[model samples]
Target: MQLNIFELTSIYLYITLAACAFYLAIMFFQKINRTRGSGVDLGPIFGLGFFVLFFGIVYVCWGYMHYFGYEYDFHPLPLYKTGILMTYFALIGVVFFSEKIIGKTKFAFTFFSIGCCVYGIFFTFTEFDLRLFTYITNPITVAFILISFLYFLKVKTTGEIRKQMFSAFLCYIGFLIFFLLDIEGIKALLPFPMEISSIISSIGVIITLVYLGTIFLRFETFTEFGWKDKLRELYIIAPNGTTLFHYSFIRDERNQDLDLISSGLTGVEGILGELIQSKKKLKIVDHQDIKIIFEYGEYTTIALITYENLRIYLPKLTSLRVKFEKLFQDVLKDWSGRIEVFRPANHLVNEFFG
Candidate 1:
């Protein structure tokens, strides 16, 4: 029993392709499940499906070359032609779909994708004409990578969307690095054989796919937080529930003036007030909507408020007088179960009035 280099390469290529295909399938199904009613345009999924298919074909060709001992160049014949065309088309689909689904960043990516396609076509015909396609794709890839990096940095304030964008930016960086290596013939400078170039490029491809998968899975996590921020801003004009107000005052009289109150504070107000007056120092053993985990002198409360409810509830508690009274009651209850009996001072009201 003996194993030749060709057989070994063929086995490795088959294993890699199988792994990639399995991973892509998992991603595809996950996207289908998550995006079913998300209102996102479906173009990216279609484009990615095609891209994956073409990539599979490339791997199949590589496996065949290894098995048959064919003297095939890296970018050979019909595979090269079809692969380049499909790659460009799929990339264009991704750009258009991303722009439509996510807000548009710049049209520069569109032009860059088109340029890559044109250069790729030239390379398919010219047979590893590195000077032509590499020159065009290298600069364009680098430029897009830089642009996306900056865009992500600017917008990645806080949230899942920021994380996805950052991941995509990292993928672009990997893409740029591998591409530059290819363009500068740095792989040739290495002592190992040129096949290592393919391995390096495969790493970039894998990273890009992983980033895309994360984006597809976590799109809601990214965009929903932005909506939450906007809702929070609008909540400033809203009224706090009675319960929320009482809690605020129980916490601190000053908190009433500051308008720091929860939206769902209505129901718990009476109960909290009783507890505060009694000086019971009660710990919430178990509760729903809001959980109070109290031990010793410290109290922790976790409230679950939906985005819709928060938006709807906040505006009703608009008057400064109402907010202040609620906050005072909440603060009083919070501070060692001691109730405070004091009205806002006349001059203080006029100067630092709500």
Candidate 2:
């Protein structure tokens, strides 16, 4: 039988949403499959990716069954119950990942798993409830969004990455809001039918996630390649060849001459500037297994020392340098001996390099 315009539109909408989700899912999985890296665990990303992938597949299935079964046979969709359950399973990866980044324990997602199993099995016997979908997805989506936003909020720096993160935040908030528009209070603002808004909500979720995935992929590529694990220390050097503050990534009690390292770096610009007599200056120093990356600021210099294979982290390193310089601009001018004032900078160190 021929379908009405509304049916055809929904079929197209779901297909489009599914395509976007699959593209994002493939992109993330391909990154993992291509190589193993030593950066922060990407297990959370795997979970979030699966969330998108499963939902994408679910949309396709929904489109098919909504056309065939619901539109004609008036039957329940039992397969979608499994799809929803699997999507919840993907969030477990996110909980562990979020904890590491936010450095906070959240037990809510733990409960979400229990709810997913119980509710999923219970609902397995019933028909797919479009009205209940918002009630189910909103809680977890809001939680993840809050966790990620908090992680970025704790950082005391700004630049291109921060701006991009803001965009991601807006997209996710839009995703949540689209789902919420079904409520009477919110429905007035958009005034679209619930059916169209639900499609919009799914699209919102997929598009926002893909946007975040792009940012994560670039940063995680180096991190996964050992940038995070290989990192050893960050040193904030005063203009007068003194160590203002230092942060060690790994717990190493071994005594080392950080002051000497600071003193040696004091002339790096002058020496390299004199030799080349050019605007370009040397930034990285490689000695055996250790590589030192430097970022210069008006008040002081930031030095990051790491083990081999960490080719990049300059954006974060630059962010650290910016925060430290701004935080200690006055102190650097007077040249005080007390390092206590710089102690607060440890938060900046951990935010970027922790």
RMSD of each: 10.7, 6.9
| Number of the top-ranking candidate, with TM-score as the measure | 2
- The lDDT of each candidate is 0.45, 0.65
Residue 262's lDDT within candidate 2 is 83
Give the TM-score (vs. native) of candidate 2: 0.63
Model 1: ten consecutive residues of lowest lDDT: 230-239
lDDT (10s digit) by residue, model 1, range 201-290: 555655665565555555533333233322221111122221221222112234333233433332354377586796554433233233
Instruction: Give the winner by lDDT.
Output: 2
Score candidate 1 by lDDT: 0.45
List the candidate 1 regions with Cα displacement exceeding 4 Å. Answer: 1-7, 18-22, 38-58, 61-76, 97-102, 105-108, 111-124, 128-131, 159-168, 175-186, 199-240, 243-354
C-alpha lDDT (0 to 100) for residue 232 of candidate 2: 84
